[model samples]
Target: MNTIDEALGAVVAAGDLAGAVGLVWRGGAAQVAAVGWRDMEAGLPMHRDSLFRIASMSKPIVSAAAMTMLQERRFALEDPISRVAPEFLAMRVLRDPDGPLDDTTPADRQITFEDLLTHRAGLTQAGFHSGPIDAAHREALGPDLDSPLSPDAWISGLASLPLVGQPGASFTYGRSTDLLGLLLARMEGATLEEVLRHRVFEPLGMSDTGFSVPPDKRHRRAGLYGFDMTGKLKKIDAPPGGVALPERPGDMEFASGGAGLWSTADDYLAFARMFVDPSVKLLSPETLALMTTNRLTDPQRLGAEMFGMPTFGTGSGFGLGVSVVLDPATAQVMRGKGGVGTVGWPGAYGGWWQADPTNGSVAILLMHNMLELEQLTAGYGLGGYGAIMEFHALATA
Candidate 1:
């Protein structure tokens, strides 16, 4: 697995992965590679331009957009979110995480911009856990990936549910960023796509990045793949139609900040460059500094652990939307490449990327294969199977 083809082929031959596109940039040089098929059934070879449902990779981008809004004096991080989204004006907290729905208490205060940025807004996903709160989330907000409701309807549904914890309390990984997207749109009086395009995508020159793929670019869209019960690679679905994140007519109106965008290795590399290169100026120096730094309190770090997601490691903490590595020694537990102060996040669909501020390096691995959420929480996929550890480790070396 020393060469890119060999590395990707090993996984393809192993029956776990169908295709991969990876890029590593460091010290003003870049190495890009691709192997296997974007669609095995259709005999489509994977290319550097192949688009993948970047899942939570969308977080850092949306977070950057929010920072731009902050620079424009749209809203401060501490301002109550109710200023933009009135749905959150009066909110309730669950008395117990697993208790009945009616058992609740008044929130100590309204959720603020800072709370959503740090993921301490008491929001949580439904499918990852069990209990009444989880059920309520599923019934109200729909799945983590695709929801059938429009933006307004989705917020209406979310407003009806009780929060798992108090706002600005513990880190609960749910739809906080998605809610942020809606709020940003409301503030701009435009669609989420319009705001992100003007704020982040266009400036970064991410032409192929958006909530949905158009018809002409459909061929470049990687087919979603997953393992069958026998552990063999099975084609799941195609872009603009996958079950986890379908792109029907009205669905594009949501433009979820948490997990809605599709992008290529090169497109995301441009976005990653902003973190390490001051000249890129994708964000102001001070805002970028604050974003890459660890903003999590001690208790919030503990809550991140409870989620059991691979995006965070022992000595790492959540920043605005990305994970900040405070201690490289403890962060090595994830077996991915990075040093102290490295900032990045992984997508749900087997994508891993990191920008190492200390070393001036960026590594991105994009693939369409899906992994079980439990497997990801245990840190068994990206570095372990997709050779991301090897790819990124060699780049940094």
Candidate 2:
């Protein structure tokens, strides 16, 4: 059997990655491998504790926090979010998702909490659409991460745009969780960071996870890297389209619950443990069951598209915050492999984690596999996905 180090080292040597941290824990035993460099140019080695911009992986954490609130009877799943964020009360829906922004109709119904959780709120990211709607999203939501708008301003801006579909109609992946996080903050009368800290991080002992890296820990942060047009690894100070900034602004008020988070391998493992282990007790078993179970209808699953590919159907389903694996045989790479109820959500920056309840196991691979629009169009910067698949295969074996 190949060791984790040897398995991941091969990827680094192939120039597919600068470095990564891989971990697998099962039955009270753990295997951890830190391979390659945190910064190839700086000669810093990847460490188990090295911080990473976990991107959309932040979704699961925020969802869990929201679940905790649910358990407290703070709000019901069916409650309309308009009760708290009234900006959505009289929203419009785009007649055609890709058509002119002015061609719209009033929203058929109010968006509910569950709609946001399941990504059926009709909200969408700028990159998901083309033409007028896409431009509208970019103008409103500055970047996917570290937006300059305050939470209130951001919510108003998002509500001003027309939804891609009627609320609860179909799955349209977008800024739902980001809205959820801001709502959670509003409900708690605190910043999103404080709400998460009190609700999730502190309880899970995830000391290294947060929206920003403090000055003292700056050296431990991994430098972002991506592939150029030729498929060679290149350090990216700032990615195109402003998806992320090289340095997070100190006064930045936007805390993107969808894509903004920095965490390390062990800290995220602490978070993932709750899904597989009942003893962790982040939520009541009843609430946890609600969260991990598949929520999408068959049509919604089939209609959903992510990064221009069918998101579900093919042995997978989506729950509240995580993707549930229904069949390992035909599951897509993004869904990953595990038992019927295995749950995971991968980040855009090459971070992946899965918790298999049947096996009582967790597996994680964290890397900075940033890709630009042109690289994605040319399919030139996806070797890191291969690294993730290889790591999962080795970890399971």
Candidate 3:
């Protein structure tokens, strides 16, 4: 059998990756592999504790915090979110997604907690879509990370925009989670960072995970990278103009739920493990089940497929904050091999993790290369994904 170490070593030698931290915990044992460099310029080796700007991976953690509140009866899933966020009480929908911003109609109903959790609130990413609605999103929300606006300002801006669809009508994957993060913070009368620390991070013993890396820990942080036009790995000089690295911590006040977290592979493994084992006790079995179960309908599921996620074709659907496999056979068509019940989501910065309740299995692969359009099309990012799949396949081989 090929060892995980050999596979990781091969990837590093090929220059497809600068460094990585891979962890696979199955049965009664946990195996970890670290390779290449966390800081190639300084010749620093990647360590198990190396920190990463885990964009989008922040969703599951924030969702877990919301679940903790849900268990306490703070809010019901069916409760109209307008009960707290009155800004969304009277909302508008775009008559044409690509039409003039003023061409709109009233929403069918108020957005609810379930609508936010399931990404059916008709919100879409301004960064991903191209239209007047997208333009409004950029103007209202600013960027995805490290927003210069306060939470109050951010929410006010977002509320002023028109939704892409009526509430609970379809899946729009842009900013629902980010809004959820703020809503969770508002529910607690604290910042998103404070709420997550109290509810999720502290209990899980994820000491190093947080919204930003302090000055002292900056050395342990991996530099973000992306493939150049020549297909060579290079440090990202300036992460696209409007987008921000919210996890890095700066003058920004908004803790974006959609993307804003810095963590190590081990820290995330601990988070993923909770889904497989109730002993972690982050949430009750029922709440955890709600998170991992498929929460999207057929059309909603099809909406995600349009984004070009390979796994979407294989019967995958969105859960609360992660992706769930509805058909194991179809899901196996992806580079990674997970069981029918596997649930986890990947970060835009070449990070992936999965938890399979069937075998008490958890696997995480962490890297810093940003997934660009050209790179994904050329299978450059899949080089790391293929390794993760190989690790899973090796476990059963």
- Residue-pair clashes per candidate: 0, 0, 1
Q: What residue pairs are clashing in model 1? A: none
| Model 3: lDDT to the true structure | 0.79
Candidate 2 ranges with C-alpha deviation above 4 Å:
none
Report the C-alpha lDDT of model 1 over 57-132, residue by residue, as the tens digit.
9998999999998887889989999888788899998888778889999999999998999888987777645778
Alpha carbon deviation, residue 347, candidate 1 (Å): 0.6
Q: Candidate 3 — which pairs collide?
A: 125-174
Which candidate number would show the highest lDDT if scored against the true structure? Answer: 2
lDDT of 2 by residue, 34-131 (tens): 99999999798999899999988999999999999999999999999999999999989989999988999999989999999999999998888876
- Among these predictions, the greatest TM-score belongs to 2
Write down the TM-score for model 3: 0.93
lDDT of 3 by residue, 1-397 (tens): 2387788878778877888888888775788888888888889998888998888788888888888998999999899888879888899998987778899999989999988887889888775566877777777777778777889889889999988888998877778899999999998899898899999899999988987888889889887767776667777743444487424446667988888888998889889889787679888888888887888778677655335553365468877777888887777523234677688777777777888888788888888877666566776656666666665666445
Alpha carbon deviation, residue 31, candidate 3 (Å):
0.4
The TM-score of predicted model 2 comes to 0.98
